[model samples]
Target: MSAPLRVLGIESSCDETGIALVECAPAGEPQGVPRLLAHALHSQIEMHQAYGGVVPELASRDHIRRVVPLLRETLAASGLGLEAIDVVAYTRGPGLAGALLVGAGMGCALGLALDRPVLGVHHLEGHLLSPFLSADPPEFPFVALLVSGGHTQLMRVDGVGRYELLGETIDDAAGEAFDKTAKMLGLGYPGGPALSRLAEQGDPAAHALPRPLMKTDNLDFSFAGLKTAVWTRMQRLEAEHGQPIAADGMARPRADLAASTQAAIVDVLLNKSLSALRRTGLKRLVVAGGVGANRRLREQLDEACRRRGVRVHYPELHLCTDNGAMIALAGAMRLQSGQAVAERHYAFDVRPRWDLSAL
Candidate 1:
C-alpha cells in the first residue's frame, strides 16, 4: 500500500484567490479514482467590478491579504493543518505578473515553512483539468477549448505536460469580444454575464452579427472583427436614429441585441470546436476557462457535440472560473503519475505571458 499524499493548492492568476486541500493515494477504489478533500475559493470580482475590469496591482494586493485567511479556513474545513500538507501547488504564469507573484510568493513560502514539495501549475492547465473535479471525469487524450477574456485556444491534451496547440484566437478572445460588445451597448463592467442574462429575454434574430474567421480552413479564430462589426452596427444605428438614439430604442430591446450577439458568438465557438473534433478524430471535448460558465455556450455546445456523436465535458459553474481546487487536483494528478516529488524550492518566478504549449 502507498502512503496518502495530501496537497495544498493556491491560485491567484487573476482576480480570484483560491486555496484547496486535496488527498490522493496510489491505490484507487475498485474502479480507480482520485479523491478530493476540501476546496475553498475567494473571488474578488465584485471588488474589481467598479473599475470595469481587474486592476493588476489591486488584484495582487487583495491576494496577499486573502491567501492566508483562505488557507487557514480551508485547512480548518478539512480538519487538517500546515503539517498535513505534503505539497504546495500554485499557478506560475500566463496572468498578471503582480497577481502571479502574490500566489507564487505565498506558495513558496508555505512550502519552505512546511518543509513540503512545491509544484508550479500552469493557469490554463488548471482550467483544463477543472472538469476532473466533477463527479464524472473525462478520459485523457481529449480536445480542450479554453475560451476566456484573455485567451481562446484549442489544444489536444495527451496527458499532463503533454499538450499540443491546435488553434487559437489571432486577436481578441471570445470573452473579450463579449465584454467589448456589451460595453458598446451600454452594459457595464464584467459584461459577459450581464450581457448573457439580457440575452435570455432577447430575440435571437433581432440583429445580424458576423461570425469572424468561421470559413477558414485553419482552426485559428479572430474575434477582433466581431467586436468591430458590433461597433459598426451601433454606429449605423446611431446614424439612423440620431445621437444617443431614442430611449425606447435602447431599453429592454437591448435584450434582443444581446441575444443576437450571444448567438453569433456561440455559433462561431461551436463550429470551431466541431471542426477541431472532426479534424482530430477525437470524440471527447473539454471546455474550460471563464467563458465555460456561459449557459448559452454550454447548451449549444452540448447539442452540437450530441449531434456529432462526441462527448463533452465541462467544469461545474463554480469550477469553470478560476479556483484553487483545480490546481490541487492537477497537482495531485502529477503526484499520482510520478511527475512530482517531495522537495522544497525557494526559486519562484512568475510568467505573465506564457505559452501553454511551452509547458
Candidate 2:
C-alpha cells in the first residue's frame, strides 16, 4: 500500500491564524474522507474588538506573531515533525490582502524548507466542503448554503471542484447584516454572536422587519436596506425614550429589535434555501460558514428539512468559522480527485476578491 499523504494547512485570510494537519490516501488508492490529525487556531477577535472591526495592517502583524507558534503547537499535538508532511496548503483568496499574503508567504516558505509541494486553496471552497468533516457527512450532488461575514451563496455540489453557483447576495451577506444591525443596536464589535444572544431574550415577533427579496422568484439576496431599517428603528426608539437605547444594559426595546432583526434574516435564509432545494430537486442540503452556527437558522432549517424529507448537514460548530483543517482537507480532496495538483514553484500571489465560481 502507498504511504498516506500528510498535509499541513495554514489559514490567515482574516482575523484568525489557524494551523492543522490532515492525513489521507494518495490518488488511485482506496478513496476515503481525509482525517484531521491535529489543529490550533488563534482568533484576533479580542485585538480587533476595540477598533470596532479588523484593521488589515494590525491583523497582518498579529498573524506573523501567531502563525509560527500555532504551527509548532499543532505539530507537537500531532507528534509529527516537519518532514512528515507531504503537502502544504493555505487559504489563497477573497480576504484581506495583507492577511492573505502572510499565510501564503508562510506556506511557501514551509514548502521550500520541507521540499514539499504547496497548494493554494480557495477560502469559500474550504467553507463549502467543510461539512465533510462532520460526523454526519453528506454525499455528493447536494445543495450548499455558504454564509459568512463577506459572502452569502448557494451552490449545487457534484463533488470536489465541481460546484454550480445557484444564488448569492446582491449586497450585504447574512453575517454582514447581523453585524451591521448589531452595530445600529449599539452592540459591541463582533456583533453577530452578541445579537443572537440578545435575541434569545426578546420576542421575535415584537417588531416587524422587512424580509428583503423573500417574495421574489429569484434567489438573490439584499440586506443593505435591512441595515437602514434597523437604524431607522433605533432612532425612533431613542426618540421615544428621550435617550439612546443602551445595548450593554440589555434593555427590552433593544432586545426586541435584535430578535426582530434575527427573525427577518433567518426567515429569508430558510425560505431561499428551501426554494433552492426545490429548484434543484436535491434531497440533501449542507450549510457551512460562520452564520451556519446561528441557532435560530439551524432550528428552522432542521424543522423545514424534516417536513420536506430532506437531509441537512453542518460542520461542527468550532469548525464553522475559518480554520486550517478545512483548507488542508480541501487540498487533500482536490489532489485525490485529480482536480488539482501541488506546485513546486515558490512564487505566490493572492486574490483579495476572487470569485468562487471562477475556480
Candidate 3:
C-alpha cells in the first residue's frame, strides 16, 4: 500500500469552529474510508444565546479566536506535528461570509507556511459524506438526505464530488422549522435540542398539526406552513387560557405542542427520504446533517427502512453536526477518486452561497 496522505481540516462555517486530521490512500489504490486521526470542535452556543440566534459578526470573531487553539488540540491528539500534514483543507462556502473567511484564510495560510497544497471543501458536501467516518461506513450510489440548518435536500450520490440534486426545500429547511418552532415555545438559543428534549414528554397526536406537502408526489418539501400552523395553535391556546402559553411550567401544553411539532417535521423528512429511495431504486439511505441527530427522526427512519429491507446509515451522532473531520475526509476522497486536486496558489476567497451541484 502507498503511504497515506495526511490532511489538516478546518471548519468555521457557522457557530462552530472545528479542526481535525484525516488520512487516506493516494490515487491508484483502493479508496476505503478515510481515517479520522483526531478532531476538536468549539461551539459558540453560549455566546450566541443572548441573541436567540447567531450573530455573524460575533460568530466570525469567535472563529478567529478558536481556530488556532482547536488546530493545536487536534494535532496534539493525533500525536502529529504541523510538518506531518500533506495538505490543508477548509470549509469554503454556503455559510456566513465572515465565518467562512476565517477557516479559508487559516487553511490557505497554513498551506503557504507548510509549502503543501490546499483544498476548499463544500460545507454541505462535507455533511453529505460524513457517514463514512462512522464505524459502519456506507458504500457508493446511495440516496443521501442532506438535512441541516439552512438546507433540506435529497441528493443522488453516485460517488465523491458526484452529486445530483433530486429535491430540496422550497421554504424554510427542517432545522429552521425545528428552531423556529422551539423559539415560539420560548426555548432559548440552541432551540432544536431543547425542544427535542421537551418533545419526549408529550403525545405527538394531541394537537392534530398539519404536515405540509406530505402528500405531494414530488420529493420537494415545504415547512413554512407547518411553522404557521404551530403558531396558530399556540395563539388559540393562549386565548383559551387568558394568558400567553409559555415553554416553562406548562408541561402538558408545551410538551404536547413540542412533540406534535417534532412529529410533523420528522414525518415530512422521513417520507421525502423514502420517496427519494423508491424513485431511485436504491436500497441504501444515508442520513446526515444536524437534524439527522433528532431521536424521533432516527427512530422512525430506522423502523420504516427496516420494514422495507433497506439499509440505513448515519454519521456517528457527534459527527452529525458541522465539523472539520468531514471536510478533511472529503478532500482525501476527492483526491482518491481523481475528482479534485489540491492547489498551491494560496490566494483565498470564500463563497457564501456555493451550491453542491456546482461541484
Candidate 1 worst ten-residue window by lDDT: 26-35
Q: What would the per-residue lDDT of candidate 2 be over residues 1-359, giving only the tens digit for each residue? A: 99999998899999999999999999999999999999999999999999998999999999999999999999999999998999999989989999999999999999999889999999999999999889998899999999988799989999998999989999999999999888777788899999999999989998788999999999888999888888888888888887787845449999999999999999999999999999999999999999999999999999999999999999999999999999999999999999999988789999999899888
Q: Alpha carbon lDDT of residue 232, candidate 2?
A: 88
- Model 3 lDDT per residue over 1-359, tens place: 77899988899999999999999888888767789999999999999999999999999999999999999999999999999999999999889999999999999999999899999999999999999999999998999999989799999999998899999999999999999999998988899999999999999998988888889898888999999999999998877766666835466888899999999999999999999999999999999999999999999999999999999999999999999998998888888899999999899999999888989
TM-score, each model? 0.95, 0.99, 0.98
Clashes of each: 0, 0, 0
Which residue pairs in model 1 clash with each other? Answer: none
Reference-based TM-score, model 3:
0.98
- Candidate number with the higher TM-score (1 or 3): 3
Off by over 4 Å in 2: 247-250
Query: What is the lDDT, from 0 to 100, of the residue 143 in candidate 3?
Result: 98
- Higher-TM-score candidate of 1 and 2: 2
Candidates' RMSD to native = 2.1, 1.0, 0.9
With candidate 1 superimposed using the best TM-score fit, by how many Å does residue 319's alpha carbon deviate from the native?
A: 0.4
Model 3 regions more than 4 Å off: 247-249
> What does candidate 1's lDDT look like per residue over 1-359, in tens digits?
65687888899998999999888775242223356778788888789889888899899999999999998889899998688888899998878999999999999998888778798888888888888888778998999999866799999998877889999999999899889888887777788888898889889887888889899899898888878877777777677666552256665557777788889988989999999999999999999988999998999999888988899999888888888998888887866766656457778998888898887
Clash pairs (backbone) in predicted model 2: none
